[model samples]
Structures are given as structure tokens and as C-alpha cells.
Target: MPLKKLTYLLLTCLFASLLTGAPAYGQRTKKTRAQLENEKKRNLEKIAETKKALENAQAQKEVTVGNIKAIKEQISSQEEQINLMEQDIDLIDMEMQDIVSAKEGLETKLQQLQKEYAAMLYSASKNSGKLNKLSFLFSASSFNELFMRYKYLQQYTENRKAQVIQMNKVAALLRERQSNLEGKRSDKKRILSAKVVETKNLEDLKTRQTAMVGELSKKETDLRTEIEASKRSVTRLDNLIANIVAREISRKNKERERLQDQEAKIAKNRPTKQPAKKSENLDGAETALGRSFGASRARLPWPVQRGFISDRFGVKEHPVLHGVLINNNGIDIQTPSNATVRAVYDGTVKDISEIPGLGKVVTIQHGEYFTVYANINQVFASVGQKIAAKETIGTAGVSSGATEINFQIWHNTERLNPESWLVPR
Candidate 1:
């Protein structure tokens, strides 16, 4: 029986250890509540931004295809917000479960401690008479036995005191765990309420998106006509860009030849036989500027502070028109009306012109590389003027009844995707 009791004790201790160890391990691996809350806050900010963009898009009197796109984007943001809220609710639920487990563990420990404390008190009560304790110590068989009895009494006294202290400690801990569990329950309730509201909002946004898409789908003919006009505008812009690039190239070549001829004349007047090195296509300042611009690839700032890419570069099927492809030389960013447009990098304003269908456009040169900002309502910088990165160069112009900017990056005559160059929105 003694052996069986010893085995049972060992098993009980092992079970308790595993129970306590599991939560400890989980606590080490799990994200804290603060971390989850911070992520949720950021997600809320993104939702707010998308809502603002949607409001701006709606402000336009005419309901164009862009308005539908804006609504779709707003719906996407609402869905993401709902997802984040769900994640937050899940985290709260996990926290509540953990709190419940902790409360249970504390209750178990407190019960065991109370039982041990009661047992100690009962044993002490049975030997409450001081005379009995003294006589029991004195009735030892030998001096050594008497000393052992005294030591045993002393140990017993200490054990009783320690048990009482441990009981109190466990009771306090159990109370703390109970309070924490209540708090967690309350938090779970609040999060669940929030989740319900967010889910409803998401559903409403989805319905609105469906309606917008449906309305736009009925105007396929008008959308197709708009697409055709946009295609023509893009073609005209491309032709103008090409002409500008050719002109710049021609002027650079002429400058290079002039420099080379001057160098040749100077070399002829020199008394040395060393040939002059070929003149560089760009001047020293321009070459340095180019190096700086090239080094900043994929790190350049957005042309507008607040916007989203409405159209991406390369070939894409028209959003509203079926069986139609639109080739985009640059990305189209949708922003608030009259949003300030800024330079992506430091450069000189090569030219500023108004294309018939493209609106006001400003082109800046960074050596061989050029960045063009189109669909500008107003130009702040002029031709041949030096501009710094993030400097306000113009205001975004309205297009298709929505504020939009067409941004392009070019290396000499070769057009590159502006999205690849600009920082992620």
C-alpha cells in the first residue's frame, strides 16, 4: 500500500507539472495583447484612408467608371478591416481561455493548500495542551530520543506556520486570477460586439460595391468609348514623349561633339602627343545627379502623398470594357481633387506643356533618366528650374471625373514602369 501511494504521488506531481508547463510554453510563444492591438490600430488607419479616398471619388458630380473602382477599393478595405477585427476577436478569445485555465489552476492549488493547512491545524489542535507536548518530549527512551522528539516538535511547528503562509499565498493568487478572468471576459464581450459591427459594415460595403459594378456594367458602350478616348490620349502622350526624348538626345549629341572639337583644338595647341579622352554624353553635374537618381531606384517617394494606383503599367484588360486591352506606359494614381504633386527625385525641369487630352504635364531630367508627371491641374515649377525630391511641383488634375495623375519613368527613350521605381503605397 505504501509503495502504491508513493507511485500515485509521483503520477500526480507529473500531471501537475505538465499542466503548468503547457501554459508556460504557450505564453512564451504567443503574441502579447499589446502587439495585437497595435496591428489592429494600423489596420483601422488603412481603412480610414480608403474611406477618405472613396469620399473624394464620390465628390465628383459625374459617376464614371473610376467611381466604381473607388467603391470596389473601399469594399476591399472594409473586408480587410473585418478580417483584422476577427483576428482581434480570436486573440481576445484565446486570452480569455488562458485566463480561465489560470483561474482553474489557481483554484486547484488553493484547494490543495487549504486542505494541507486544515490538516496541519487539526493535528495541532489534537496536541493543543502545552503539558502534553512537554511530557511527550520528556518521556523519550534515551537522551538521543528526547533530542529527536524536540527537533520533531520544532519542525512540526515550523511546518504548520509555513502551511498557513502558503495557504494565504494561494488564496491571494486565486483571487488575482479570478479578477483577471473577469477582466478578460469583459474584454471578450467588447471585442465580440466590435466584430459584429465590423462584419455588418463589411457586408454593407460589399452590397454597395455590387450595386456600383451593376450600374457600370449597364453602361458598357459609354465605357468602351471612354476606353477608346483614353487609348488615343495615351498614344498622343507617347508620341510627345518620343519627340521630346529625340530632341534631348539630339541636343546632347551636339553638345558632346562641340566639347570634343574644343578638346581637339586644345590638344592640337598642346606640345604633348597624348590624345584627349572621348567627351562624356553628360556633364559632371548631370552625371553625379544621374548616379544619385539611379542609386535611389525602388526608394523614390510617391508623386502624391495620398493616393492608390488606379491603373498599373503594362497591358491589362479594361476594367469595364470586355475584349479590350489597354497598354499603359505608366501607372495611373487616383488621389483627392487638387492633391499636391511632388517630385520623386532631384532634377531640373526639362519642359512643362499641356497635352490636349493628357492635361498639364511636367517633365524633369536626371541626366539620361526622366520622370514625367501628367494630369496636373497647376504647375508650381517651370522649365529649366531646379527641383528637389518631395518638392511640390504641381497639383493632381482630374481625369474621368476623378482626381488622377499619370506618372512615368524613363531611361533616355526607354519607358519603365513607374510603380517599380516608386515606393509601395
Candidate 2:
């Protein structure tokens, strides 16, 4: 092939090779942007919910433990929002850097193309004075040489035109990249402004929380009494669920024994198998239901439509009382007054009872797993009724000057953290 054709082919292959590496990088950046946006959306939603809950608590005109908890949650979400903004700024910076680098590369390419085109023009002009195009071709020794000369001139002119077009394209692309870089910078500036506002809001929430805690600390004696009453309520609910679950296990065991006896009478001479394990002896349907419920870990819907956990599971020191620890059997969700409570998963209503200081309670059983919803004001489902996921069971009742509910999950007699079971907000 001619030198000009070979050079064109080599340049085309080089451009193609450069283009082939773009999609994977683009896909990765797209995924990162999507994830960041999703996280920010979730953070904002939590902030909104916490704001509503705080508004409801403030409307009561009394600073209670629930109010302080809501403020703390608000502060947490606000800080998270600010962090997300920082992440956005960081991502934009990275994008701008890439654009700057690409713009520089395009500028360099355009310069090279212009330089080459100028050199080609100078060479053609110098040769033009020596022999005009028609004379140059006709002066060849034979018709074949003349034809070859004509083809060379044609390719040489085309190469210069191609260089000029390429330079124009690179310049246009550089302009577009500059525009994109400016856009990213503008985005970073906007997010930084929002972040400043969020930081201020977070500081305000923390100040309010400190004031509430200081006020609560003044009522240490009353707070202690209330804490004791709440513990009693938790103990009562725990016993209720334990007794009910025990009875359920006994019933299943009796039914299994009855079947075994009937089988024994039918096949007297048959060899007896070893006693089945406790889990194996349980009803097959119950076992399957337990498996399904277990499989749904971290995917179950919230019992209430909107709320944040005011109190987490396990034992922790009280926020106001010095050296005082509160043992929580379940997570406490702070929601709006009379907010409807729904079942997190499909189960049968095992028990519903009212206890002192805790309002009404409803317990649902999913095979060996049991979920208890307490602090309910009104119960809608009856005992032994089958309930589906997100089915309304009752409405939350007010406590601690704010509306809230205690939600728990248990496997047989062992308590499981509701936070681990429920999906992230």
C-alpha cells in the first residue's frame, strides 16, 4: 500500500483502540453515581421522617425522652446528608479531572494535526512552483508512470483535507469537554452550599438534644421510676410470649407422639427408628415457614409506615441517668400518634394482651419465629387469625409524651434483634 494509505490505516487502528477502553470506565462511573444518588435519597427520606416525628413531639409542648431521641436521630441523618454531599463533590472533582486530562489530550492532537497539515501545504507549494500538476503527470516516462503520478497527487491532497477535518473535530470535542468540566464544578459548588446548610441544621439539632437531656437529668428520680415500670412491662411481655410459645411447642409434640403411637400399632414388628430431633419433630409446615422467614432476614418491611428506632435492642446505658443501664427486649420505634402498625411478615396472631405501662400488645408467630408488637392502642386482628406481610394489626399508642411502639423478633425462646431482621430505611 502507499505510504499515505498505510499512515491513515495506522491512525484509524490507534483511534479504535483508544475508543474500546471507554465503555467499561463509563459503566463503572455510572454505577458509582447511581449508588451515591440512592444513598442520598435514603438519607433525605430518613431526615424527612425524623422531622415529622420531631414536629409531632414538639406539638405536645413537653420535652420527653422520645423528643430527645428524635432530635438525636435527626442529627444523625443530617450529618449523613452532609457526608453524602461531600461524596458528591468528590465524585465531581474526579470527573472534572478526567475532563481536564481529555481536553488537554484533544488540544495536543489538534496542534499535531495542524502542524502536519501546514508542513504538507508548504511541501506542496514548493513542488508546485517546479512543476504544475498536469505537467508533473504528463512528464512521466510512460502511461503507467503518469497514472501512478496522478494517484499520488490525489492521495496527498486527500490526506491534507482529512487532517484539517480531524483537527476541527478534536477542537469541537475539546470545547464540549470544557463545558462538561464547568458543569461538574457548578454541581460541586451547589452541593457544598447545601452541605453548609445541613451542617448548621445538624448543629442546631445537637444543641436542642443537649437541652432536652439536661432537662431530663433534673428529673432523675422520676425517670428512674419510669424506667423501672418500663422494665416490668418488658418482663411481663417476655413471659407472655414465652408461655405462649411453650404451649405451642407442647401441642406440636403431643400431636407428633400421637402419630407415632398410631404408626407403632400399625407396624408392631417393624424396627423403631431413633427419636427425631426437636426441630425434626415439629410440624413440617411450621419448619418450612420458619425457613422462609429466616430467608427474609434484612428484607422484611417496617411494622409501621414511618418511624425511626428510638431505642435499640440489648442493654445500654440510659441517655440521662448516670451509671443506669436500660435492658431493652426489642427495638422501640417512634412514630406519629395512632399510626397504624402492620405485620412484617406472614404469620398467625398468637397472642394479644394489655399490660400496665405498655398499653396493648400483639404477638404473631411465624413457625418457630415470633414477632411481638407492643404499645398498641387498638387491636384489629383476633387471636389465631392468619396475617400477611404488611397487614394492619393495630395502631400505635403514645408513651413518654410521644407515640411509639416496641417491636421484637424471637426464635423459639431466644430473642433476635429486630434491626437485623428489618430492611434498612
Candidate 3:
């Protein structure tokens, strides 16, 4: 029973080894890493947005320990499978060594058997020519001795024939097994290399997952605190702006009263012809302002100092995820996130307001031209304020997420596409 179990175990190991060897061998069959790499790199920029989102998500709390555990489990499973494949290959190698030894032994025996067969065939031919085989049986002294001699000759011929046939069969089987073992050798090597790479990738993924979970644990608390602080700041800013607007309106009323008194004196003293010329000039000024509203593309100025348009103004499909369309009123510039958001041209500040969905937006008016810079994190100028070209009017507001500056070009009420102005990336 012990012998039986041992034999069974040996057979089971052999069978299992064979099953494992195939997959190890199979892994080296095909790959396209360069294609995969080219695809991945030509594409990291697109995921810049996703990375930004993940960065924001990191600051939040409520990281599920379960998800982290699951990732670890998956990594463990892959490692276990790799290990099994390695063990199976090792067993197969041992089996191959045994087969190799058997093959060598069989080869030696085959050579010896062939030599014996060759000698027998030669003897048979010589005896046929000289009649030694016939003479041996006929010259026997007794019938029993002659019968015994005949039986010995017959058995010798039969044994030689059987050995030649057996040698050929064994040689064939050995060659076939050797060829299979050679294949297994290459297969085992390939599988080992693959497992090493996969193991590294798994380790990297696990590390990232663990780090993400850790970050998430702190991020939630931080986000809540940030949100509350932002609300209070927003409220305070609103009240301050209201007071500023009231003061400005009062100042404008007083200035208008002073201008009216000067105008009344000038009306009594100036010539009638001067008033006619003044009226015509006023009409022309109004017409010029109206014509400048949403003027030709050539009149527009670039927004940022040193950047190209990464994305254009208009409706277009997303670069990474196909079939998804994005509507953009203005172009997106590719530059460092920390870069300053400056005025595109000389303009007067029109309205600075916190737009719920759009963040803080600052509207500036240049003659009759209007520009809107949205998603502002900080503002340096206020309403009814004068700003020069390239002035640092506001700083971009980032949500600890993707830092994007939403900009708009408007002429009074007419909106112009920013794409027409900015150079394409």
C-alpha cells in the first residue's frame, strides 16, 4: 500500500508538472511592449486631468479599508499563481533530467543491441552460403541433442529480432521526450522572466493603493475644514464688495453733480457752432463703440504670456476618452498651474463676483471690449478700478484639483471665441 501510494504520488506530481510547464512555456509566445509604451506615454498628458482628480480625492476621508484589502488580496492571488507556476516548472525540470538520463542509457543499450543484431545478420548470411546451420543440426550425436541445438538457434534469432525492434522503439520514444524537454526548458525560462515582471508590477500597484488609502484617510477631514473656511471667506468678500459698490455709487453721483454745474456754465458761454460739433462727435463715439463690439479676430490679443492653446474654443471630442464631447467657450492654455493670470489688455474692472459653479470671476472692460477671467483664487483689483495691459489683476483659484483658468472675451454683449486669438498647441 505504501508503494502504491508512492507510485500514485509520483504520477500525480508528473502530471501536475506537465500541466504547469505548458503555461510557463506559453508566456514567451507573444508580446507588444513598445506599442503599449508608446500608447501609454503619448497619453500621460490626457490623464493629467484624472491625476488631478485623484489628487483632490486624496484629501478626502472615508477610505474603505475593504477596497484596500481587496487590492492586497488580488496581489496575493497573482503572486501565489506565479509561485505555483515556478514550482511546477521546477518539478518538470527534475522529470526532464530523469528522462534525459533514461534517454542516454537507452542510447547506449541501443548501440550495443545494434552491434549484436549486425553480427547476427552477418552470421546468418555466412551460414546460408556455407551450410553451417544445417550441418550443426544434422551432425548432432543424438536426436535429443539435435532437437536442443535447433531450439537454441531458433530462440537466438527470435531474441535478436525482438531486441532490434525494442531498441528502435526506445530510441524513438527517447528522441521525442528529449525534444519535449528542450521545449520545456525554454518555456520555463520565459515563464520565470514574465513572473518577475508581473511581480514587480503587482508590488507597484499595491504600494500605490496603500498610499492612496492613507491619503484618503486624512483628505476628508481636510476637505471639510477647507470648505467651511471657503464659505466664511466668500461671505466676507460679498459684504465688503457691497460696501465698496455703495461708496463708488455715491462718489460717482457727486462727480456727476460737479460735471453738470461745469456743463451749465459752458453752455451759457460757448458758441452755438461748438455744440453742433460736440453733438456730432458724441454720435461718432457711440457708433465707434458699437462697431468695436465683437470686432474681427485680428483685433484680439493673446491671453497668457508664454503658452499655446492645448485645447481650442468650441465643441470637440475629448482626446483620451473617445465619443465624449466638451463644450468650451474659450481655449485652454498649456502652462504651469502656478503661472499668474494677468490682464490681456488695458481695461477697467467691471464686475467681480463669485459665480457658484464657475468660482470667482473678474470682468474687465477695455474701451468697449470686455474680458472675463474665471476660476480666480485671488483678486488684486476691485470693481470700477483701472488696470493696465499685462497687469496682475487676479490669481487663478485651484481646488487642490485640476488647476484650470476659465476665460471669456466679450464686446459689450457679443461673445467672441478665444480660439481665434490663441496659437494652437
Candidate 4:
């Protein structure tokens, strides 16, 4: 209501607003930092896993495709780690700058409060004498004026106390900001140090990859033979999966036709035309399951607990052979020997078969979708058995010169890229 009180109220509101708004930026920055750190941790774990796979492959005492793949994967993860470190450093720098700016603003506010308090103290000293205070009240023209003078003195005293409290709070906040800045600097230093180690590791991996590729190039003749054998195994597995999938599709089609005929007979028996409920169709569950699985695109868990993709879907040039291409229907995941394989989604085991060089295979039907896990050493799922997501299905087998499994996702007849469906490593 009074000028001084109104001014004080406005200042308090402004300060409160600033305090409330500040955390939004800080929270967002903190979230970004956390995300980067988490990604970096995952990347480091991937590098460690790839290193173990490489060590196993190297035990053969000669360069192999598996060894080369492991080296490349390690290098990729190492590079990504370094990149994350750089991003972390940048974030730290930015946050430090913000802290500096905030500290400066707080210091300015503290100084302003001190100046105002000093002025109040100076004015208060001039009226320190009891006679002066009484003279001022007595000099009022009326009782109302005198009462107003008394209230003014009380408000002035309260404002001075409030100013002191504000100054103390601002000073404390400044100290906190300075400490945070120091912590950020330390974080940046640590990331920079880790970056150095990661960069060195990356270089080492690159050297190993180059040497392995060179060595394998010299054995191109044997490489071709290996490729031929792998191709035959792939071809045979493709045929088997195709046949199984076709039979399943045909069976579902016949059932759908039978349902359609039954629905027509019921409709004919009705007195009036009635619409067939879509939910009653056999494809209802399939549609719902397909939608659920599709919604989980890029979020499905890996078939194995720990592994890196050694070979991707579609066709790629052979690592050692010139002008030669290798075609893959599914992505190959390289894992530790006897790694337990699991279903990526809820499905029913539709078939279990074995190829000569590819070992055993398990095919699971998820509504209209089918997932094929080949190169399995053992199968834990039987045909017609219901499987839940992440349920252990089998153990990985050594195939194509590596302990890995070929993972494929199919939409009835069309093959989908398994990596696209899988979560990023």
C-alpha cells in the first residue's frame, strides 16, 4: 500500500521469479549431461565386449573375418567414447560460463543491497537521538499524521532487516555457484583425460584392423572357399526359413477363408443384414501384435545379452575378396562362445531345424511377423511352444568362422532389417 512496502514486495517477487526460473536451465543441462554420461558408459561397455570377442578370435593364431569385425567394432565404440567425452567437455564449459554469469549477477545484487542498507543506516543515524524521533512525531499536523509517521519508522526498520536477509542469501548462492563451477572444471579435466586414453585405444584398434585385413588378403584363395561354404549355408538356411514361413502363411490363409465362410453362413441366417465384428476375425490378435511389435521399432532388446553386429543385413563386399559380394538375409551378432540366445519379442516357436554347417535354427512367429535365429548350437524352445520376450531360446553356435548367430525379422514374405528393430548397442 505504501511506496516503500510496494517497492519491497516488487523486489521480493522479482527475486522469487529469478530463483524459480533458474532451475529450468540447470535441470535441462543436468539431464543432457546425464544422458551423455550414460551413452558413454554404454559405449565403453560395448568396447570391452568387442575386445573379448577379438581376443577369442585371435586365439586361432591367424587373421579371420571375426577378428577383423571385432577390431572394427572396438574402434567404432572407442571413437564414439571420445566423441562423447568431447561433448561432455563442451557442456561443462558452457555450464561454467553460466555459473560465472550467475555469480556476477548475484554479486551485483549483493552490492546494490549493501548500498541501500548503508543509505538506510546513514538516515537512521541522523534520527538516532530519542529527542529527534519524538520531535519528528510531535511535529505532525494531526493525530493521523503522527500515526502515519510512527508506521513509517516501523516499516523502515523492517525493510532494513529484510535487505540484510536478502544480501546474506545472495552471498550464499554465489558461493554455491562458484563451487559448482569448480566441480564442472574438474569434470571437464576428467573427460579430457579419458578422451586421451580412448583415442589411443582407437588408434591401436585401427592398426589391428589394418594388419588383419592385410593378412587375410594374402589368403584370398582360402577366403573364397570359406565364402563359398558360408554362402551355401546361408542359401540352405534361407530355403528352410522360406519353406517354413510359407507353410505357416498358407495355414493362416486357409483358416481365414474358413472363418469368412462361417461368418457368411451366420450372416445369411440373420433376419436382417448385420455387420461382422472386426474383433471376431482371427487376424485381430495378429493385427494388435503386429502393431505392438512395430511400435517397438528401434527399441527391441538384443537376442543375446551381449554382442555386437559382425555382419549386417543385405549385401556387402567380402572383407578379403576383390569384386566379390556376400549376401546376407539377416544380421550376424558376434558374442562370447555359448552365449544364451533369447527371443526379441513374444512369439510362438513355429519350427526348429538344422543346417549342415549352420547348426540348429529356431523360428518364432509373432502374429504376422516371424523371427529366425540361426547358427544355434542348442535349442531350448520346441515347436508350437509359446515364447515370451527375452525368454532364453537357445545357445549361440560358431558359424562362418565365428561364434555368432544370424538374426532375422520377417513380415510374412518380406525380410526386414534386424538391426533396425534392435536397440542400439
Cα lDDT tens digits for candidate 3, 1-425: 44324433443454344434433422432233333334434333333433343344445443432233333434554455555556656655665676576556656655765775676678779877877777989989999999987987776666565656565665676577678778868877886888788688668766877675565455555545644564565455444344544554565567667766767787888887785222223234433643554454555455555433444567775332235454555554433456578886665787888865457878776545567776687788998788776788766665324355667675544556766643321
Error of 2 at 156 (Å): 4.3
- For residue 101, give model 3's deviation from the true position in Å: 1.7
Per-residue error for 258 in candidate 2, Å, reads: 2.9
The 10-residue segment with the lowest total lDDT in model 4? 270-279
What order do you get sorting by lDDT, best first?
Answer: 2, 4, 1, 3
Q: Which ten residues in a row have the lowest lDDT in candidate 3?
A: 276-285
Give per-residue lDDT, candidate 3, residue 201.
67
Off by over 4 Å in 2: 21-26, 132-161, 268-282
| Candidate scoring better on lDDT of 1 and 3 | 1
What order do you get sorting by TM-score, best first?
Answer: 4, 2, 1, 3
Quote the positional error of residue 27 for candidate 2 in Å.
3.5
Candidate lDDT values, in order: 0.76, 0.84, 0.57, 0.83
Q: Count the backbone clashes (under 3 Å) in each candidate.
A: 0, 0, 5, 0
Over 275-354, each residue of candidate 1 has an lDDT whose tens digit, in order, gives 66655555778878878888887899999888877777899776666678888899888887779999999999988988
Give per-residue CA lDDT, model 2, range 1-425, as digits (tens).
87778766655654454345323335557889999999998888888888998887777787888887788778878888888888888888877777777777667766766776777789889998998999999899999999899989898888777777666766777777778878888888888888888888888888888888998889888999999998898889889999988998998889899878766665665556845333235388888898999999899999999888888899988867769999888899988777999999999998999999889999999998999999899999999999999999999998887789999999999999999989988
Q: Model 4's lDDT to the true fold?
A: 0.83
Q: Which one is best on TM-score?
A: 4
| Residues 259-337, model 4: lDDT tens digits | 8888778777766756655426777787788789878889999999988888888988876666899898989899988
